[model samples]
Target: MIYSSEHFSISLLQPKDALQLNKLLVSNTERFIRFLPKTLEENTTLESTQYYIKRKIKSAKKRNEFVFIIHDKHSIDIIGMIILKNLDWKIKKGEFAYCIGKRFKGKGLMSKAIKATTNYVIEELGLETLQILSHKTNLSSVNTALGSGFEWQATLKDEFKPLNKAPLDMELFEFSRPDRF
Candidate 1:
């Protein structure tokens, strides 16, 4: 399903998005490589991006994960991606990860995506809690998570090992649906 607003839209990443996803990754490699090391390693080409998209689609069908790409409402250009992953059916919780192109930074696009996705997770998916983990130094990511209503949870020690860099700590943030009972 597609989610939209006046400025941008969100849709599931499909095989048709391979070329745009590849270009986005390549153009923002330096900025994203650290956060998306595994994804960058796997989807290095258009063919690989297509393969990745197919896998994600299968995961969504299985109710395991949902990945959405953020696009400009007018131009239809991909600006970022938001993923609801690590879903635990028993616990009613999921993990989130998001990234935006450097050119699209500081525009509040990701914050909107995160908030929209969180609502979908809670209302449509029936997930109670959504968690986000970001490198402590990534102020933009931290701010986006906070602005999206994810509260500070904890700091995980040596949570991420970026390429060619020392192990980094990650701050965990979480949002949970209010109790109805």
Candidate 2:
């Protein structure tokens, strides 16, 4: 799927995107560590990042999962990525995850990318619901969810624990079919 907004374009990730994706992932390590465990931080080598990209592309082809990279049309720089995974056709549901390069945050790029991705998933893929889970303390993530029309669902206490850190609460949010408008 390919989508374009005024500032960015959202398109299916390609195998050739591995190198750029790896660089972005590594550069944004600090931001990613906010949600992921420290072990993840330590394991984010270029090889591991390449492995992840390959897996995502493969899974997208096999399971109707869609992963897209956000890029500036002019510069063609990768700014972020969004993934719609774990698609359940029977229930028409899927989980959404996204991350923006630290340099691209606060520019409204995320909201635009999400809106474009959600539209494609709902209209093209026929998904009826989308779920987003984030750490409670990640205010930017929570705000992004709400901004994209996801409603507060519930909180799961001590749902995740980063290596050497205390367990953290997770907030669940959902955007139903009707919420698109």
Candidate 3:
């Protein structure tokens, strides 16, 4: 089922969306890589992306991971994507990740999307804590996490090495279920 709100709708990524998804990733690769691992943008091909998305959808079903596309209601254009992965039912925790197209930045679209997606993760998926990891250099991502109610956590030193880049520090953030607040 699609999750809808006044500003945007979150829906499962489908096979038919392959072309559009590829275009979205290609167009936003530079902006996306600033916060994500650089390897995601490097060596990306439509076919490989298609394969990856298809696998994510299947994995979402099996592992309770949810991958959603954030779309503008009026324009029907995809603005971003959010992923909840590694759902551990015993711990009631999951890893959260997201990317918004450059064109849609600073419009509060991602904050809305995060609110909607987190609601689903909590109400529908029964998750308690959402963990978000981002590069220290990406302030926008850090802002998004904070805006979405994630608390700042300690930084991990030299935890990740982006493709073709030196090891970098990563900031770990956490947002708990409202009841935990």
Candidate 4:
């Protein structure tokens, strides 16, 4: 299902979206290098992006992970992506990882995208808790999480390790639904 607002739309990443997704990542490579290291390496080429998308589609079908594309409302251009991963079915929990093109930042787009995806996890998918981990210094991500209604939970020291980079500290933010009770 697709979610939308006046500015953008969000939906499952489809096979045909490989090219657009690749472009988005290529353009945002430097910005993503620190937090999205593995993702950056996975989509470094058109063919690799195709493979990544296929894997994501299969993962979604298996209910293990999901990748959603964020697009401009006026066109099909992919501007960002949100990943629902690190899922723990037994604990009813999951973590979100996201990124948008540099041109799309500072416009409140990611925050809305996060909220829509979070609703899908908590309401439709019946997950009880959600988390977003970002480097404490990444104010944009930190603000986006807070804006999307996720509360600061804790600081996880040395929680993120980028390729060949020193381990970095991350701030954990969480949102949980009580309706399951």
Candidate 5:
């Protein structure tokens, strides 16, 4: 297990999780389309989801990115995903992106998962800096970053552009390995 909480367990996303992963995406279509358009496109069909999982596994093998699935503790149903992407090996920097099915929102799973995963990325993967980027209007995401100990860095202008929408400013929240003063 990569991490566990009272009601969920996180682990490397496996090829066998395609069906449930697709279901999670299908169920959250309305909620995820704005920011997670690309991800949603990947899971729009079971066959596509399977292919996506294979690609993700290969990417993880190359250390280009990492993907974890959040499963319900009881049934092991995939309910969410957390990914470490945009890796910069030269600088030991990476960015985090995550999403949960609408049915599982407001449950603190994301906040806890992000905190635990950040620790794993820094301690085990040797990354020095991790970033959580959110649109300024996303209060819940911003709060998740703050609650997980990320410090507000800056507002990146035109950092994100939702499909069919104007570009948006993104809030940059960073979590870096603390200095040993």
Candidate 6:
């Protein structure tokens, strides 16, 4: 599914995007690690990124997860990525996660992308509820969640432990599909 906004678009990461994703990750290593250390640690090279993308494709084909890459509308550059994961088919629930390149920070691109993806999954994929987990210290992420209509559901104690750091509390935000009928 491709979702287009005024300045950016979100779509599945094609195999051709591996190299660009690698470069983007390398350049934003510091910023990314601040929020997404594990993701950065895994996709440290073009080969690893290709492997990750392949895995995403497999998961997508199986209808287990969906990963979307955010691109600059004009340049088509890879600027960020989002995932709808940990889907529970019986309850129609999924967790969402996302990260943006440092250069793309403060552009409101992620908020737009999040809102678009959340709507797509709920409306098109028949997901009943979506959740976003963000570290309490990450105000930008919290803002993005709230801006995209996700309400604060709870504070999960020690939900995430960043590398070499004490376990940090995480805020759980959720959005439920509105009654349409």
* lDDT (10s digit) by residue, model 3, range 1-181: 4588777788887776676677778887777674565326532787877887777778887977777888777775778888887688998999888988888888877877787788888888788999888876677788888888888888989877776788888899888887875
Query: For candidate 2, lDDT tens digit of each residue in 1-181?
Result: 4797667888888767766777777777778865644324533676776677677678777877777899877675788888787789999999888898888888777877787788888888889999888886677788889888889999989877776788888898998888545
Better of 4 and 6 by TM-score: 4
List candidate 2 stretches off by more than 4 Å.
36-47, 179-181
Task: Please provide TM-scores, in order, for all candidate models, with all chains considered together.
Answer: 0.94, 0.86, 0.88, 0.96, 0.96, 0.94
Q: Score residue 153 of candidate 1 by CA lDDT.
A: 93
RMSD of each: 1.4, 2.8, 2.3, 1.1, 1.2, 1.6
TM-score of 3: 0.88
TM-score of 1: 0.94
Relative to the true structure, how large is the alpha-carbon lDDT of every model?
A: 0.88, 0.78, 0.78, 0.92, 0.89, 0.86
Top-scoring candidate (lDDT) = 4
Model 6 RMSD vs true structure = 1.6
Model 4, TM vs. native:
0.96
Clashing pairs in 3: none
Q: How many residue pairs clash (N, CA or C atoms closer than 3 angstroms) in each of the candidate models, in the order given?
A: 0, 0, 0, 0, 0, 0
- What is the C-alpha local distance difference test score of candidate 3? 0.78
Alpha-carbon runs more than 4 Å astray in model 4 = 178-181
| lDDT, candidate 4, at 104 | 91
The per-residue C-alpha lDDT of model 1 at residue 106 equals 98
lDDT tens digits, residues 41-110, model 4?
Answer: 9999999999999999999999899999998988768999999999999999999999999989999999
